[model samples]
Target: MRDIYSNVLVKQSLTPAVRTATATGTAVDRNAGGGAMFQNALVVVTTGVITDATHTITVEDSADGTSYATVAAEYLQGTAPAIVAADDSKTYELGYLGRKRYLRVVSTVAGATTGGAVAALVVLSDPRVTPVVRA
Candidate 1:
């Protein structure tokens, strides 16, 4: 049988929290396991209990880990999501195919009075090392 869990590592880019304003996710080091170790990445976003707000999700990349820029459309496998109250209890995934070593997810919240619960996870795969360590 094929084992998917053993070859990949997952990290939280955005901690689960109710947000009322714009939030920039934590930088996920693509080389955390090892230098240039991972060849693929996917950002997964989950939402819960959305209120009177609109949330827009965008993915960004950085080579130096400090300076980041929005990822171009050509390097992304799927479109970033613009979430609304109707999108509550939903999930979205975007694949990153750029060469940057760091990645993050950003959320732009608007017209929010009660805010929304949102979170993001970065899945790193195609590793040069086996059996990724869980932290």
Candidate 2:
């Protein structure tokens, strides 16, 4: 049995050059799967000018990146106040159940309108162990 250390496998910022209503969030390829490297994989997201309240965010996965599936979903709503601007960022954590190389985030609500603009931030990380066994 192979043992791997728990560390940040990948990290990236979700910044788009052209600000659009429909924009692809951050994504990362694990490239570590087969036996158990992906068994305890964890995904963490950090938002800026975005809050868990008033918006529904999710972490999606896909083998081909083009087609994706919702690995985990979270809806930020409750007693917390609505997130009006992109100044206060929130942190979200999620764990991967199955094997997936590609992962990304999708925002249902783009927050409130500010000067006719909407924005959101997403950070994705995949932490896993080592030594994946093949069938």
Candidate 3:
């Protein structure tokens, strides 16, 4: 058996302006052969609005960091926590079934009208350990 320590493999931010129905924000590439091993991860997104109204935000992931897939499709309404004005920041924690190499975030709402703003994105990996035997 063997034991592995967990560490912060990567961290980044994506704030691409939305002009069309959808826009790709940014890509997080982890090309380390085995990739980052973890059991859980976290995604933090911050937004600012001209008015205290509702806005929608979505998070996604990609294997290659280029072509992404939707991880969270639900629209984060104003009622949700961390969905407040830009003055404040929202932190979201996401659980993973297995290990993932690449991750990304996408904003459905576009333009200054919606107050779409992203402060930063943080990812956390789980610690892995295995049994060891000695003679």
**Superposed Cα deviation of residue 78, candidate 1 (Å):** 1.3
Q: What is the C-alpha lDDT of each candidate?
A: 0.89, 0.44, 0.44
Q: Compose the digit string of candidate 2's lDDT tens values, residues 16-129.
A: 222224345666555533322343445444445432224444567788867887663332222222233442555555555556666665555553332112232322223344
Least lDDT summed over 10 consecutive residues: which range in candidate 3?
126-135
Off by over 4 Å in 2: 1-7, 16-22, 32-39, 50-53, 72-87, 115-135
Please give the RMSD to the true structure for each candidate, in Å. 1.7, 7.0, 7.7
Cα error, candidate 2, residue 50 (Å): 4.4
lDDT minimum window of 10 residues, candidate 2: 75-84
Q: Backbone clashes per model, in order?
A: 0, 3, 1
What lDDT score is found at residue 70 in candidate 3? 62
Name the top TM-score candidate. Answer: 1
Off by over 4 Å in 1: 34-36
The runs of at least 3 residues in candidate 3 whose Cα sits more than 4 Å from the true structure, single-residue gaps closed, are: 1-6, 15-23, 30-39, 48-54, 72-88, 98-100, 110-116, 127-135
lDDT tens digits by residue: candidate 1, 1-135: 137877788889889999999999999988866453788999999999998798899999999999999999999988899888888899998999899999999999999999999999999998777666666
lDDT of 3 by residue, 1-135 (tens): 222333444356455232223344555543322443444455666543324333344556666656666664342222223343444344544443323456665554433354534443645444342221111
